[model samples]
Target: MDKKNLKDESILNHDDYKDQHGAVVPPLYQNSLFTFDSWDSIDQAFDHKTEAFIYSRILNPTVKVAEDKIAALCRGEKAKLCASGIAAITSAILHCVRAGDHIVTIKNIYGPTNKFINSYLKTKFNISSTFVDGRDVAEFENAIQENTTLIYLESPASLTMELQDLKAIAQLAQSRNIKTVIDNTWASPIFQKPLTMGIDIEVHSASKYLGGHSDVVAGVIISNKEILDSILMAEHELLGAKMAPFEGWLILRSLRTLPIRMRALMDNTMAVAKFLENDERVGKVNYPGLESFEQYDLGQNQMTGYGCLLSFELLTKDIEKIKQFVDSLQLFSLGVSWGGHDSLVYAPIISYLKELSPEQFDAMGINASLIRISVGLEHTDDLVADLHQALSRIA
Candidate 1:
């Protein structure tokens, strides 16, 4: 178990833990704790001074493999895996903000993130927050306070697909001496690299794309070495929200095929987005890939690829007709998460409205009949036929 004696430190490696059978994939280390050869070794691990993983709660060989691959994907100094996407996000926010700290964030990020900041932190901690339109750098500048410690953002902001200029925002946050964090889950580090733009930190809901099979629910934080260490101490070790070894194994398998899966997913997405845009029944398809999108140029400037998620409101606002359309779909599954081989559809009016205030809803134009689709690896022709039939149901 000596680090200096290792031959290769590839993403597929589990340090030097060689199986007697010479297996290609590392064997899952499912036990809760590891035995020490001597009393000094145990002391070294507990002291936060040793790289040796002593407990599954803190670290495991299988989980470490996934973490290493994620870190490499993000081009980060380090990475930490968590139980769920919220675990990764909440931990990063809580770790960065102490009581009385202020946060300025984009209006439409992931719903759970909005709830965590507006509801949970507002009630328990004295952290203050201001939500703004991130598409305008001036809004971010205007929202900053003397106490502002963090600036959080999500580009192609959740369902609405509003684009943010990451490089400009990062520069603004840097000049203000404020920390910058972003949810890069939508682009999956395949199409966008936030860290390279001078952003301080990036996070992902590994449950969606990283797992790629709709099986494991996991999260990750990719950032500088110092910030990761701080989060590891506060949220990871103290809260005991580490990913299970078995789940880690599944994610590793998914990571191996991520590149190919993402290529096919994007191709399907482009095809589907075009089909939705051209349809007479569809209104305001919110995909950056389309030249008709308001921020299409901005998205093209920052993102290397058009991602797999898009939302559109029906020309008809009847809720009953919308339900019929959703229920009639064959290829796309009705579910919450995506990045699997199977496509998914969800109504934000059903879940997202519960979190937004009446005034916010009015300002944002919360279309009751809107539909969001997470494109998958399905053949484009078949997926289009499934969607066309669903639209026919509504008519």
Candidate 2:
């Protein structure tokens, strides 16, 4: 139990803890509810006097391990797990911004997140939001109002991959006395730690790279102990958006291989971006790792490494040509999500921000022919060949 010599692995690594049966892997505590020995013990647990699982909806040991691991990775005082990435996003936002409060968000975030903030939250909770190009610090400052409660952002902002100055924005939020939250899905904690940059809350769709296999859907939120304790009290306790025990165990297993998987992915991705950058059929490439990227310097300042996500545009806006390119791919799977052992691809025209228009896209530097590619652990040559054939067909 020595903190100094804990196998030189992260606390989330299952190797850090042996199961009750002394099994190397932690056994899944799959039971939905826990039993108490007596009425007094049950009452004590209900009162939060002792650490005992009363119900699966509120707390579970397996999920707790996952939460602790994520919290430690983000250098957060505490963490909580949710059923899905959207759950993490919603829980993180709702836990702070209540009815009548206002929020300011980036324009080109994930589609469902935008829907949730623009339509759902407004209808259900009467909360309002102003969507702005998050890359512009002046816009974020201008959007802040007296009632602005939350400032939400997705750095390397979803399809366009624009990098925002985290320190400047956090300082702006602090000056205005507003809460700041970031969707850390694109750049995982290994790449960027928003908490370290003075952000209040960080959320991730662990369903992506954190799971690394695309088999499980999970989400996590890490925050300072104060905000985390509040989320634990309200979101964790009352609303009960707890992650399933089995999913938590899967996440723990995935965490062990995350660093290895991400390295392979990002390396392959950088190569792919470079390949497409030279392709005459390609209109543009959006990747932070690329030296030609407008925000490359800022990205380097904020992230430990450029991540596996990359998007590129074709010279043609023909949707059929786009479909042809996707269909010609043999190595990369035509899938919705990324960050798996297998590479994935999707057309930004179809899958990215739903509200984005041609003018908006042009303004944001995203073209109609854009394709979002998530590189995987496949052989670099094979991926390049696939891209070559795919692009040839479009040509």
Candidate 3:
């Protein structure tokens, strides 16, 4: 099948399941290893003379189906599925650098990812990194050193929802021979295609939007075959973070409804963002969909749709007031992580007050009163009412 000619919905729903005995869904191959009928078959599999699954950790029929679907959706040559989002992220990062290599990354990247680059790689691998604001392509360009081998990014970054100019940065990185990797978890393949914009690799925490029900924890790395082949042998297989068959099946199920869910979430979130923006008690709404956003034009150019995740600052900077507003929201469950069916609220101050220095907080535009919301599949009126009543508490 020519995936390039198909729409995302078609790719997600039907791309990899056609050969599965007319089954509506792909069947899960739950075993740990595939046995060969003859010694010659085993030798052929080992030598890559024939396509065969030898071990579950290396490859599984079920996981490959999910990988193929995601790769097609992202318009990438191949994909590697991992046990968790961090696994995919770390694997991709590892594949791009060696000892003494430097990385330029966004200041407000995902928390675990920030830690991995700043702490783990720095202390263990002798690797170094610089954090850029990511709003300006020049920030990335200025950070590149002779040793810089990778430029990592998270557009609509973490809490502040800041965006990077993907095309500009990609061009900059390519010119400098630096690999560009973007965490596309916020947009998913449905909204953004970083690969199409010349990014070297696209990473996702499938636990978020891809596993929309929040039941599965998985991650995927999408890129050309050459890059993925190297990672598949080195960081992916050697690191032993392959996605399980059951988890792959769950991700496949979620793919079927991805387009529908994303569109609905976008609509619901836009309504919620507008409500907060108009409310007197809300300080600044940090959703890219809002015209008032600083990077609204850039977001429109790069992304097809603004996603469900958004953050807003309360008019007051008091922690107590922020807590009251958050606690008042009966519909939004206070927690970390977003992009699921249930609405969630996370207060960065509650968790990061002690974890981050004052300068770090300033750099990321995070504050005590900032509240992040992940809008779900609920009716727009109910979500708006929930926000209305929650804002009333702060008022």
Q: Which scores higher on lDDT, 1 or 3?
A: 3
Give lDDT: candidate 2, residue 392. Answer: 94
> What residue runs in model 1 are displaced by over 4 Å at the alpha carbon?
1-20, 48-50, 353-360
C-alpha TM-scores of all predictions: 0.93, 0.93, 0.97
RMSD of 3: 1.6
Q: Count the backbone clashes (under 3 Å) in each candidate.
A: 0, 0, 0
Q: What is the lDDT of candidate 2?
A: 0.84
Where does candidate 3 stray beyond 4 Å?
Answer: 1-4, 15-21, 49-51, 357-364
Query: What digit string (tens of lDDT, one per residue) describes model 3 on residues 138-164?
Result: 888899999999999999886789999
- Clashes (candidate 3): 0
| Tens digits of per-residue lDDT for model 2, 1-395 | 56533331456464566665788777799989999999999988978722458888777888787777777778887888888888889888987798989999988888889899999989998999999977779999898888999999999875779888999999999988899999988888878989999999999988899899989988888998778777777776777777889999999888887766777788899899999998887877999999999889999999988678888878888878888998899988887887778899988667444666667767865677788888888899999999999899989
Runs off by more than 4 Å, candidate 2: 1-9, 14-16, 49-51, 351-365
Q: Please, what's the RMSD in Å of model 1? A: 3.5
